[model samples]
Target: MQFDRDRFRFGIEAEYLLADKATFRPLWHNDVTFAELHNLMEAIPFDDLPSMDGLELEPPHRKLMPYVVEGYHVPNPDFSPIDILPKGVEIRTPVCSSIGECLECLKTLHDRLEAALSGSGYTLVSLSHHPTEHHFEGPQNKRRYDFWQWAMEVMTTCGPDINVSLPRELNDPIDVADLHRKVNYYSPALAALSLASPIYRGKLWKIRGTVGKSIRTYRRSVIAPAIELHPEENGRMEFKLFEATNRLEDYHAFFLLWLTLLLDEGLKGRSRDQSRIYDLGAVARFGLEAETVRERAGEVFAQAPVVLNRHGFDAGPLNIMKKRLETGRLPADDIIDYFDETGSLEDVLKTRTGLIHGTELAQDSSVNAAALSRSRQSMTGI
Candidate 1:
């Protein structure tokens, strides 16, 4: 399908840990202290670099309105042994309209931050989560703290302590809806982007996406809301609908549905079985939809003939589907092979029989072109 060329853009938001001016170790201080340090740095003129210096400013506290903090322990009135304090600094790169531009901006920002902090008795550590970082009793900013306090009361009742950064540049300008979808669809990939929480409290956590998991969990409890997609109105494969439904339920449900769909495709000899298939039935039992269950068993007969004519049971589609299916569940290989395999409509039709020939897939089905377009735009960052 033809795609909108103007949909690609990139931005970066980097969160840094604050440390003592004398010691290089993680520092825990109140909001006043952090604000003072931030002010001090703001007043200093530093040379810029590609990776660190291209940053626009210490991201104003207002930009982090969307995030909530949780998972880390905070001191409470009932049991207050030692004061728990945490300080953070945020840096946002210049927004680029393309991936290439974004990368260039990132390089500049990275270099600037490095040069500016050198020999300053401070450094910025790139990580999804810091093992030694502790949570303060409350949020650093009043707006964040108040909003989260109310949000937790209305939502899943969790604390907020998460931080996020986006690239400063974009290759293209994206629609608002597409932006949301991009944020939601690529969440797992973004989660994979900086999986630096391998060690928690100075011990191996044995989880690859520790920061991803913690952030997602905290989001679900504090930010995510119950929303649904109307198939007739929104169209199939819409990210908003998909995310709305996915967020309304548990991750297990989402995973089960994804696995079932893949299995159905596989049973028809349309694809190869992934290692996770061994646990399919158990996953299905964990609240999978009846439609998914039926589809899994019936897919072989339903799509078999078409799949046979299309790809002839090659592993490419299966592999791609498996990577998409396994997101947020397990550790995946690079998936570079599958990533490059997604083909055009004609390519798909030549490989799969049921697909309409020489026509957009959205046109042939009830799929919403706008939604699909947005999803693709978000996924490809194009």
Candidate 2:
């Protein structure tokens, strides 16, 4: 069962808060919106995605995709979980053979979805939590959306779920029981880098009324099974640590970081301390700079390239990630700064979160060039 080479494919599934662009309020996904989603998936064409695939719609009119994802999970344009207030929908990409293709296809998916919602007076915002409003609504699915929404509400006031997945069995780097252990152990740093929820339910959640600086960390953030985990022949690891982000490059950078680790001799080379889990609340509130024990997981992420290049794998992607690591800046830092200056969570989203422009997404020379360029463009206006 240990036969391996680096030939594997990857994909991404990201969800967004469906909100009114002008008001930044979550919108309900009813029958009409469902119909619109179906038509839009059909009418919208992807100029960049190689698939340019024709969509196949599932029953109940809640899902759309050109194909199934390796006979697993709902393909992108998924609209399941038909009940909940402050509705959210997910767009997932079928697995791709390379990081470049995965990211480009994901960007194309975002563009197609954005264009479809253009006339609907609603825009999909990719923040982890609804900035200014409280949500308690969903479709008519009594058991799935309604019951769970109510259940979750009673626990921590109210919350939204948005996250991305990385395949544990993809190709290399980490695998088997150790892969699971490393993933579980690194949840803190991963969550830190993925932080996007600075405001929660109309309040600055990074600080408490009396406890000084605090994070509104959701209860489900501890890599709990309830949030979800699926281990297929070709499986994926779902991390609930990150808030949703629309920028394809952010996904690109993250996966690049993953790639570096994969080629590193150090990942599968050592036995890590299983008890080294850091505080999720701390990482969520302070991304990148969040303190994690270097021996536990930080060294693996930071030194992936240095050790990896010595092993002969491409170090390009690793270097790219290291550059960002050098900056020590994260999306949450900018988000909180904007929130503090504007005094409006809605304004912070409008200014910081981006809706990827199609052509601008194609500036390809090298994966490194496109990624570096996109990273710069992603942060410019902010």
Candidate 3:
């Protein structure tokens, strides 16, 4: 089978916290809001995604609403991974042939979401962890156990899954496994670039101190899967190490870097899962400040240009990661600094990532529930 580069698709699913616009606290009793958002999202038209002959998407989940309600789950011996309680919302992009298309799709979904929430007293925030409010639990199964902590972890953390699906012609298991292994090896260094969860347990981690770049990453160490390959055939490789970032361009950079790594045959660096897990723990604490992580990340950043160039991809997107590595800084640094300067978590939350705010939102007279409904009906044939 001849592999056509155009057949490769890019997609993303980003999870965000729903917060009270005024108080900046996690918004509770949000099912109605989520339902409304999902309905509006469903109204958006999705194109018939490019597909290969004789291949089908095993789950066909991408065809659903672009925005989905996300929940937290605890493992049970009887029904493990089944019991889930809603905690946040996720924005998923339609699979597209180019990173730019994926970015635009994400932006459209985000804008619609923002328009819906403009006057509703709620706002979507992109962050790895919620600033306040713990003790999250469902009505039943409040039993104390090691597994219950897993649900708590999910409730508190939010992030994005950067997905890359290979062309069906190239879906070789050996090649897929190699890509998975390479992604796992470099997960720690790549994760360090977007560490934004500086708050933990309802306070600045270490109380205005820089103990680590991300408290969330430190907690998820080895317990959670950092990367996943889905569908029995023509699998989509999803890298889950990135924290939620405000800028879509940051996501573009990360996606391009993943693609570069996927295509780079010359880069031979690899590591055992155990070593990668250990490095992730260190990165959680020190981020790029960790000498080992910085060195490894530096090497990857240096090689990215070569791979991107060879593959006919523009190398400009990498400047974000390059700058972070150069300065030993991550998004967490900015969050921590802002909190220190203002002494108000609400002020920090007010800083926009992808959502509209203030007068700009007031001027968005075009998007509304009815408009979305009419649009949804028109696009149903898609």
Candidate 4:
């Protein structure tokens, strides 16, 4: 069950918070906003997708909550306030043959989605949890989310990670259990590389009073070989490690890094000690500043370039990981530092495009940050 680079393709599922620009708090008006979105998407005049990044004519149909069965959903106007996630929309990309194609398609999908959100007052943001907030709203569906709400309430206080999907064709030979083990072993590296959720309920995770700790992704590990790996299911597997990263560089770098590492036999089960599992939690808690995992991540990043270069990726995209190793400055680190300096989350999230602007750390021009259409609509209050 060797990694098949030629046969592999990937997609993205980016979750965003529908936030009130004034208070930096999460908001969701499922009735008006959801209908606006639906009607706008409904008006699009296409049956089948034309291209990965081309104009999409179809939108995911909305379903009532309770999540009784696996299905798609529209907003529930009849319900009261709920956690922004259940009501918030996730911009997903169609499975694409290459990283470039996937990203391009995502850009288009994101653009059209944002266009629909125009005049809606609420804007999309990629915060893991409301920076300084809590949810008192009831579940989206009593039957479906009741169990989830209970578990998240009973088991953990935090929420989901920035999950992505990589496609392996149905015809490809994938040993489910073996592949699952290898993937779970390496999944933590993705979280370490793409850490965007640093603050929760208005303070740094370390100091936040709510949970006594932050880093939502580490609250629990999912049942491995998540969904798409099932024999009868879709031909994709989920990487449930990363928090919400709005950067294209992080998206591209992550999937490519996964591919490279997957192919590198030396990287598989490279850690012999407890650090393999413990360090993922450390990464969630401290980003690249985690002492032990950062060291190991550096070693892996150093080796991945050779493999990435072989696959026609210039390796410049992996610069974020390199920057993290050299300086211990993941994206979350800088964002936190900036917030500490100015006491502004909106400024940091709004102005910073990716982790690659005016960067003195590594000036690799080949390292591309393809955020051509960044939304500058500031979530500010007068």
Candidate maximizing lDDT = 3
Best by TM-score: 3
What are the runs in model 2 whose C-alpha is more than 4 Å off? 1-6, 26-39, 45-59, 66-86, 134-175, 206-217, 223-233, 236-240, 260-265, 268-278, 288-297, 306-328, 356-382
Candidates' TM-scores? 0.38, 0.67, 0.79, 0.68
Which of candidates 1 and 2 reaches a greater TM-score? 2
Tens-place lDDT per residue, model 3, 140-244, is: 333665556565667767889998887654455337567667766777888999899887665688624445578878878767777887775347778888888
**lDDT of the structure predicted as candidate 1:** 0.29
When summed lDDT is taken over every stretch of 10 residues in candidate 1, the lowest stretch is: 240-249
lDDT of 1 by residue, 1-382 (tens): 2223233222433344434334445443432243444344454332231233222222332222211112222334443212223344444444333323333333344444444454455544432334343232343222356554543332111111111121112212323343333233222221221122222333333334332223222223223321222223211111111110101011112222222222222332221123113222222122122124223323333443343224212222223223433342322111111223652212211221110111112221112346445433433212
lDDT of 3 at 157: 74
Q: Candidates' lDDT values, in order?
A: 0.29, 0.48, 0.67, 0.49
Please report how far candidate 2 places residue 108 from its true position, in Å: 1.5
TM-score of 3: 0.79
The Cα error of candidate 4 at residue 20, in Å, is 3.3
Which residue pairs of candidate 3 clash? 212-285
Report how far residue 101 has shifted in candidate 2, in Å.
Answer: 1.2
Any runs in candidate 4 off by more than 4 Å, and if so which? Answer: 1-6, 21-25, 29-37, 40-85, 135-174, 207-214, 220-234, 270-277, 352-382
Per-candidate clash tally: 56, 6, 1, 11
